[model samples]
Target: MNKKTLLFTALLVFGILQSGYTPPEEGMFPLSELHKLDLKKAGLKIDQKEIYNPNGTSLVDALVNVGGCTGSFISNEGLIITNHHCAFSAVQLASTPENDYLNKGLVAKSKEEEIEAKGLTCRITDSYEDVSNRVLGAVAQITDPSSRLQLINNTMKNIVNEAEQKDPTIKAEVSEMFIGKTYVLFRYKTILDVRLVYVPNRQIGEFGGETDNWVWPRHTGDFSFMRAYVSKDGKPTKYSKDNVPYTPKKFLKVNANGTDEEDFVFILGYPGRTFRHRPSEFITYQQKFVLPYTSELYDFQNQTMENAGKKDKRIEIKLATRIKRNANVMKNYRGKLQGLRGIDLIGQKKQEDAALAEFINNNVAEKAKYGNLMKDIDELYKVINGDANRDLWLSQIYNSTSLLAVSRNINNFKTALDAQPAAQKQGFFDQNINQVKQALSNSYSSFELDVDKTILKRMLNDAAAFSPQQKVNAVNKITSKGSNSAALIDQFIKHTFELSKLKNQDYVLNILLKNPKSISAYQDALLQLEQDLNKQIAALKPEKDRREGLLNKLMGDYVNVKEKFLKKDFIPDANSTLRLTYGYVRGYWPADATYMKPYTTIKGIIEKGATGNPDFGYPETIKTLWNAKDFGPFAKKDLNDVPVSFLYNMDTTGGNSGSPIMNANGELIGVNFDRAYGATINDYAWNESYSRSIGVDIRYVLWVATKIDKADFLIKEIGIKL
Candidate 1:
């Protein structure tokens, strides 16, 4: 069949299914809604109270939001388990040539041996309450979009303030769900003294590396362990030698028996974002323009880092975390773009939207409320399509330049200094001095002049690619002279870096500390360039804000109307909110004649090892142990070998990495790290047939900790279960 025929067939099948279609039990549903689902029918073996309880500690209490990734307590002593990639930044921060944790790995044999994870923090949800009535009441009278937004913000701030005043140690925020249809207040206990406990070498943790990322039948370990410490008084406190290991009220029990296909499973984590309910125009704009544009920018970044890393190991160490992050995003976007086409997402979304439009038009009151919503939203996208591209390019350019970012930090301090009262000027200057010092310290620690030069040059050239109507004059002027050629841009970068005060440590320090007055104090070539770019953004801010306000108002109205019209408990889009998604342990058929098993065993690792790529290669000791057929008790009896990774039909996204995948009885079964390439489309549309979350099996984690690393203490600490 031709492409169009296949799409038409698929659409027909989908429409037929829709008549009786149960919303796939595949959603990141809020905890409160768990009671609404028939747990027995859906294969759940545990009660909703076991997972979440506002009055008492439950499974949710064991989960931690770790550096934008999810983690869970595995021991009462606060041993936390998360993905290696999730802890990548902390590992990278603690790494150096003489004692590179990334290369050699870490094993804190005792509590005293554990090193602090600087600038890392974890929070456990203390409570989540519905506050929709209160929030809506506060903004009921507001009509103007800006005023409405301001009132909502103020109300949320007041709510948060009251909650915080009750317990200074807790952090609270009010988040809107279903757009503005619902509001929830989440309170969390912030733990600051996180410590590195264990991390495997990259050869093991990041076994498949970028090549095998988001692919199926993976061998990547992708797991790490850390510990949270509290003050001697047993309260969350900053890193200090006086701190003791935190004792979490609850923790997950490891189930070493592993799971079979169709076994009930669930995931609890903060899913970053999902556009499943977004309009077709939004999806089309992203597929056609945004993804391709950002993908190219990421490609440039990856190549530059690779080129620079080959010459300097320090560069390799410094850029390892960034390169991995960029590559993941690039590949995800590419996969999503392809998946959207493969499923004819735009076509499907348009059909659904058209049907909904018809439904709205058929009713008089509904017509008055939502008749023009889709049309208005489509027009909004058209108005800002080119601007979106330009904004993304500008953002990439600003972020890629280390010196520019540093300069902006200094400018922020200057702004703060000027904003303070005259009597409080000295106190303000003193308070900000430490911040400036830390900022400079952090900037230089990972900053490589040569790498930044390469990025700056490439960014300028790419920025020039923006159409004349969308182009910024500063970028255009620089590129027009060189015709956006690499060599000319290179020369410009070299000259600018050499002449800029930002190049010298003493000059940067002098400007940042000597005069806490204005950004004008820094008469640097790089600063001038930054100022020019800032001017362009400043000039566009008013129009941008106006457009954004209109879009938000329209979207909010659309969501409110749709939720009532549908008469279903429609969950809001994921916005880094804690959520739970459940499914069965299952594999999928990605194509016509191929069916993949739910799990991959140690034997597959040996088979892939023959490829000889560093990503596929295993550590020598691990290989020897596997070769000897040394299957420990952690090995699955059915498989007769340890399961390395497994797949399940659970919904997940970026921030879901490191989430603990639990079995029906709430035992820790795996650590979610990636989704299959075809499943990338789940962010937009979930297809149960293809969508699956891949996780490193808990048995593999145990085997590695006991047999390979011989982390006997950790194994004993967690205690075994089957």
Candidate 2:
């Protein structure tokens, strides 16, 4: 509204239009590419080298891949800070009815009290190098699309294998930055001895719950702490009592002073996949098929689990994490559907693609190189869209339940064991059966009969209603055997559970592991159904692989043509790799006559908590502290309340959760958590206006850790006293 601000905004837009280049907000720029941007001009107070210096240690080394999500080492002792949701499974694993660490917050007073986070691993990026020439060069002579893809895969594997062989402590991965265009080899330092340091209760971490998830003006804390450990010699190793806290080469310092609106910020972490560069055909499929299928199915699953949980406390605890994850994704898909429809991203992509096609055809040289690109891509999509419905439904079967997932895995073990030579059969089992047991143990630990029965029943119903051409044979077998569909489903469930004997952990671990062949004698109805579905899936794999191969081969050309038409540097889409996305802390109107501020405070939590909604649940101590005006050093002078979370126009996606969003001075100001609901479209497209990312402000994190959780020791450990 101010004259100076209005003039600056106008000029910025004009410059962007004139240059035909991307703004800083649109792409998750890789660490290697940070130097290409004018960081200081963007209000970055520190040298770009401080963020990522190829020749020496820098802030990039502090970033962590906490499994699927991102985190950062905040202390020399490998104290990692990440989102509560990222550590959901770990907390759930440690929680039980009598000792509910989830409901009641946890803090380790000393290293002795820290509990092992089973199966959790924290990976710190050691370094990354471009391997495009080596990967693509090896497959240049291959003419067949399938053969070329195979060779590319083999070459990438060889590169990773060689890297890991050189250093056994490192875990290496070759990520394709662009399909058939570029590749990067990232080597990571792994820590298996990860342990929980501090975890806020559900009321704090998940404030506003699913009701406010992905919505802006958010007040969710959405943060937790864990630490990584290694052997005494500073080498990566699994959990052991003798292990010591792993000293990181670099770590981020907390900026408890926090930030305000219009402040420049950037985030470095592993962002999940994005399809912004994909052609219209891909966007259309995502909009019409993938999004709908996943959202609706997840909605049904969450509802089923919720209903079951309401009846049994045990079932509630067992399925809590699964439901939370499913519901989060379900709502996110629904938001994407809203964004795609509301913003017309699909329509926008179609227009851009049309222009690209025109550009390709207008020039003789370009036409010769890409004449059939558009048509070939359309044809490929046509085939995919034909079976989109059936294929989507079929893909969900393996992931439908823990039981089915285990069944498929163990079944593979059985198949492999049976295929070995008679002399080597026992040897094979001796080598592989333990792996099967470990997999089954994880599945069986979380397995619940009620939840699986409900999901299975729903899956069968979906399959039964499919078109005649897309019929699921397993469902058909039962439907044909009986006239009443309900009766058949019931009978199938009854016999499957009773006959399988797999519900018994002893039987599954002992008898099944010893002789997988014995499982078939039971002739379980559900197992038989799974076998039938596997056969169908097996029959479909080759055609699927062929289509995928062709698409992969063509996409490189597609990207090349688009770049030529635009005459701009093409930012590669996110693929769960380390990337840096930057922008200012800003706000925008989500709708007509409605503007959302960039920041929220503890006062918002109080107002939402009073609404009697479970999602906005809060502990009584928070109200007590606020009522008494026991504001410590954390309160903001202007607002007279601690800032809870702030919004920024940075490109982020699923795996960016728990990433440290840094201030201009390269200090941790907040932990990136969610995006505005409208910004869910960020995975497909981005704009500075609506594509805002949210972070739990470090001030709120400090206040909660100190006053509420009584974690003064952590305050001291992090070297920030408040």
Candidate 3:
């Protein structure tokens, strides 16, 4: 389908889904409501703030932004807990066939036994300090966007320099929210002494297979344990025999008795990102086009990986973790899209925009000041839409790797007759050589020809349909053949003797071989593209300037309308730090025909098991454990051999995995893992009626640690009371 047609169809789908839903009478709650609620009224202790001191810990204490995941310190001595999935990359990189840590989990018996991950360090620098006044003050005086940004950056950097000088270990980072209207300075103490502790087996940790990912009634025990190490002097230090487990000043005690319905709970961790403040048009775009397209891409990848997984055990092992991770993300985006549709998010946004327009009309006399903001924003949206296909084209070309295609491209690069301008030469070098090298590094390790063919077919088709000027270079045709392409790539790489010669091939060939020297070449190419693409985009920006201005005005209007009509206050979705949300533990029905009750028990494991797929298969040990039927009085009849999991109204996103789900009394009851926006996109704008946080019951974690793994010593270290 054409770009416009695809966008329209997506919007139509969103409209149809949203048509039937009614907005909540109370709307969503604002941050103000959090303070008004009585702690006792929500079954929470007033002393929660005293027990779990969020402010006491510096940004360096509880907040960590790693390469792929966020982490927090749990103990004074640096005991850390994060999602198992987050730790998967480190584990995979460190493991070999003889010692596959992913298949069989790992646990360090003592501080000395802990393994230090390479190229992985947890940094917590003192980077944050309030710079809201400085930013807002500058913006108040400046009208030009470029000047405003420069002023804000300069002010923020000055603040950071001052803060960092106070503490050498401190690092400051500025976070922009509401498109730079609000800024938060994050200060952290860099902690580079992180080490692996304990992790659960893949079977128990990732139960119910791909089918249950991002869905309610989840049984995945997605938790991992790690301890922070420091020098003998009790300061953060790198890996060394002299290092010891850093004792935390405070570590949460594991509460064996879990929480019930309507209990007040809170999660303290680094939540990645949320788009709650995005303009309505942008939200509409996501609901209609972006999410579905992403979901399609993920689905393709999953299928390709799964098919290849079956032939080679190694492939299965390598791809299994990635598939599950991507599946959850895909499910999340799909659910968010659906949620956006169901709640008529765009309609609500439009209503809010109208209200804001009225407010501006009544309060502001200068039409020139606010009138064109909405128009400009609309124009910006249109301009962005024109270039949206660029990403799709790029994705297709980057995701494929066929050996023959690479060989042909390499040969072409070697023999290209044209010596273009310096700028053009650099552009080709960056686009063709550098990117391919990076792709090859990651893709070569897990190469599968059949998988490449499937991805290539989709990408090639997409590229072929691209606007003539926007199409990717033509190496795709050569690699379109499955095994035939692989043979060709083999011959090309073998015949090419010198690295210098290989680097000079035409764009297509340079990309295939995964050349090492392409990095420098890519730098040159990138500079060329940046200048060209920027100039092209800059030209279109002015055409839609009027519309873009309108959209911004509309955004303000929507916010005002939401405040007037929607009773529930809308707070910015969680961004790590500490957040408290209260709601009853309840099950949800995702579709009319299916009800996902809140929990998955051990029996479900046996029922879902298949010998062919290890992901779906329950290990013999777990199966035997289930047959034993060692149930205490806690097992309910409704659960009937099924496991009982709880659902809560807590707001969470990607980085919240392994977050401690604590009761009002500050007792740990569950581990926050995933969200249930599998079929809907409600997370983008939480519709309390639907979006719910899914977590593994804390009781299960204790059971697994004490019963399953028999790590009584480690459990005792965490102060688990049975």
Go through the candidates in order and give the clash count of each.
1, 0, 86
lDDT of 3 by residue, 288-350 (tens): 667887788878888889889888777776666567766876777777776776778899877
1-722 per-residue lDDT for model 1 (tens digits)? 33654575466457546655343646888777776665555566877688887777789889999999999999999999999998888898888888899877898899888877876899888888899899878867766766666677688899999999988988999987755557898988999999999998788899888889989989989999999999999988789999888998999998878787667788999989887767788899889888888887888888988889899888899888888888999999999999999999999989877877887899899898788888988888998785776788777775687788777776667667778888888888877787787887777665778778878877777667767788877776666665535666677788888877676666677654764554435566676677788788889876776665566677777766666667765666787778888887877789998878788988888888888877887777887888898878877776788999999989898899999999989999999999999998778888788898899999899888887787888888898832
Highest lDDT, which number? 2
In candidate 1 the C-alpha lDDT for residue 88 amounts to 86
Candidates 1 and 2, the one with greater TM-score: 2
Model 2: per-residue Cα lDDT over 110-165, one tens digit each: 99999898778988888898999999899778767777877888999999999999
Sort order, TM-score high to low: 2, 1, 3
The residue pairs that clash in candidate 2, if any, are none
- TM value for model 1: 0.93
lDDT of each: 0.82, 0.86, 0.58
Weakest 10 consecutive residues of candidate 3 by summed lDDT: 23-32
| Model 3 lDDT, residue 316, Cα | 76
Using all chains and alpha carbons, the TM-scores for the candidates as numbered come to 0.93, 0.96, 0.75
